[model samples]
Target: MAKVQVLGTGCAKCGYLLKNAQVAANERQAGDVVEKLDDMLQVHEFNPSALPALAIDGKVVTVGTLPSPSEIRQLIEQSQEVEE
Candidate 1:
């Protein structure tokens, strides 16, 4: 299974991003582990310019914007394929 990490500061946007990511993962049947990191330090560990970032298996994929459900689903699908 792939590891999905949401890096944010616990803001409304951050929560929305996490929710969208979960929905996408479920829709895609990604079967990934989703983790939320609210600490900047931890987020920076993965992405130096972290701000509402999404990491799949420790690689930064999305940052800055809260992606739409469809976009997130595509991302999850791509990540799942890469894992396999």
Candidate 2:
């Protein structure tokens, strides 16, 4: 299964992003595990100052904004393609 990580400080925006990401993954039928990281140190480790970052399979895919359902689906597809 793919591993998805959302990095943020547990703010509203962060929560929204995480929810959106989860929706996207489900829509795409992606068999991935989604996790939320609210620690600053973890967010920093992702090398993004922005509050809401999306990572798929250990690679950062998005930051600073909540992706739409279509966008999230695209990301999931791309990640799956890369894995194959």
Query: Would you give me the overall lDDT of model 2?
Result: 0.82
Prediction 1 global C-alpha lDDT = 0.82
Residue 15 in model 1: lDDT: 95
Tens-place lDDT per residue, model 1, 1-84, is: 677788988988889999988887777674767889998778878854748888888888998888987897778778778878
Question: What's the residue-level lDDT of 63 in candidate 2?
Answer: 80
Q: lDDT of each prediction vs. the true structure?
A: 0.82, 0.82
Model 2, stretches more than 4 Å misplaced?
none
Which has the greatest TM-score? 2
lDDT of 2 at 10: 89
lDDT of 2 by residue, 1-84 (tens): 678798998889888888887887787674767889988877788887576889888888988878986787788788889889
Clashes of each: 0, 0
